[model samples]
Target: MREDTAQEQGLDLEPPVPMEEEKEVMEEMEVEIEDPLPCLSETDTQGIIKGRDLFGYVGIEAVLDQMRRKTMKAGFEFNIMVVGQSGLGKSTLVNTLFKSKVSRKSCTPNYEEKISKTVHLQSVSHIIEEKGVKMKLTVIDTPGFGDQINNENCWEPIVKYVNEQYEKYLKEELNVNRKRRIPDSRVHCCVYFLPATGHWLRPIDVEFMRRLGKIVSIVPVIAKADTLTLEERLEFKQRIRQDLQANGIRVYPQKEYDEDAEDRILNDKIRENIPFAVVGTDKEHQVNGNKVLGRKTKWGIIEVENVAHCEFAHLRDLLIRSHLQDLKDVTHNIHYETYRVKRLNESNANGLALSPLTLENGTLEKSEAESHL
Candidate 1:
């Protein structure tokens, strides 16, 4: 067909276009391609990739942050000592509770074989996370007061030093940045551990408790109780009641009563402290009820069975639930004072003072009024 007729009929009569000419035509019609803006910038993209790469580390960091915040919020250091006659398993009891090894061995007179000798005090600290509440429990293992080699009179001096250290911490470390300092005694609490089978109120225990009473609130715990029979336990409780009553302590079951009566009752007691409910368990011991020394129960030895069954649980609850916040505040102040004094000592260790050759200046320097003013 003629080219004009082919065109009218909608057909091509022309030869195939050259390859290079077709490519040029296509290129002329093609749209230019430019790089598209990404959803994230280069920096943001890198961050996202890094976050994906370190998901585990990120999670751990988050947990660490939470723990740090909790530590700051619950900034109280409670130093609890377990005291009793030697060989009563004070070290074992503390190690079991705090889940940390705190032990010592005799090396010389008045010396133990831990980090430092000389009846070195051992302590174990652990954190308990429950129901989102984080708590730190520090247990200090003290030498059983009447050590044969440490000298019978070692107990008094140690107690005095502890009190003095507490005072030093309060006046120095507790308030390094604050304008005022709080007393140290407000932060320390004492626990007296007694053997489950020993004489109800040993003279030594009584004397130590009496002295401790003058300084801080003291809690008495009957240790290694699984060794005693139900009847013996009951009798032991009664004897403790009598002895403490003689010393001005009141023993009573947990119950509701008139405020006036409670106050009067507490005031009448020697330490004004009641015996926590008696606790016993069969786990820490190897023998059956008769010969087994006793065992650590699911309920703390101090809180056997349950709160309803043990007075120590009630006492513990009172201290943990009621006094923990106040204790934290007090302990923070004490640590601040301790830190402050330590810094002062370090600064003055070379025999330099703010003023020399004047006792008046020294006295006034230590006083709150003078320093603050």
Candidate 2:
């Protein structure tokens, strides 16, 4: 009767398949539903693939070429700070490094006449280009840093300046409509000049580097190293290294920051020769039938680029050729990140509102300022 009623309602019923056949059909459907590609679980270790493992050619290596072209077109910025007394040849050394009039002394020519009685921060920037690669190099010169009779807290201005740059960058990052590439003014490397006293670090030197080293990459160098004998230079460098360790000061290419075995090995060599004894000169003289940058004296001309004469070449290579990008990276990643976290934490603790002043300046608005904390 039910089958007759179903037929009257236009319903059709088929015989059920045997259990074994139904099971086989179900298994086939399950096979079709399975994924072809492999998937990783949460705890699965990722396999490393080498070039030899690849079956077909993929243009992955071309990414490096793309990055190189992009970097060449976009250019970059590097801000370096020179800290020392007035007559430490800081400006001269900078000019010699870049082989250009990029220092305050070269720009002003009479910068000595305008030396301030107190520690003053002066920045001079120049757009330098070579081989189609441009760099906006800014040299921050600290005049009268340790010149005063009672030079107390001479590093205050410098420390404040570094933190200020970090703060400026932080504000821009907090803005809703932040720039695609915010202008980088933060000091990347600080070339701290230590006097060639042939003695241990002085109280001022210890204090200044101790504070600044925590905030920036401090590359302490023996200024006017030509004044010291070879023996004196060695002994002085040893003493300074000991002092640095005793005072717990952190300098550039720090061991703790090394990323891998290769970096550690390279930086280990640099650490062994810390506080590079350097002589700076912009004058060129005839040497071995070739003109060379050197300092002329009654005894002989001290070739600046000659490694035997001074460690200036090593310093130049470090600051320019090899570790220039590393300096910028450390400044942005480590130093700036440390400052950013601390500032954000402070804001969270104090419940500080985003300042209207910052909003008025169009950096951050109250409604758009998101709590990074």
| lDDT agreement with native, every candidate | 0.51, 0.86
**Where in model 1 is the C-alpha error above 4 Å?**
1-74, 95-119, 149-151, 173-187, 248-273, 277-312, 315-373
**lDDT score, residue 286, model 1?**
36
Task: Write one digit per residue (lDDT tens) for candidate 2, span 162-200.
Answer: 877887888788888989999999999999999999988
TM-score quality measure for candidate 2: 0.85
lDDT (tens digit, per residue) of candidate 1 on 41-136? 554644234555543654555888887677666643455556666655555544443334433332125754332223445555556655555555
Error of 2 at 161 (Å): 0.8
TM-scores, each model vs. reference: 0.48, 0.85
Give me the displacement of residue 330 in model 2, in angstroms: 0.9
Best by lDDT: 2
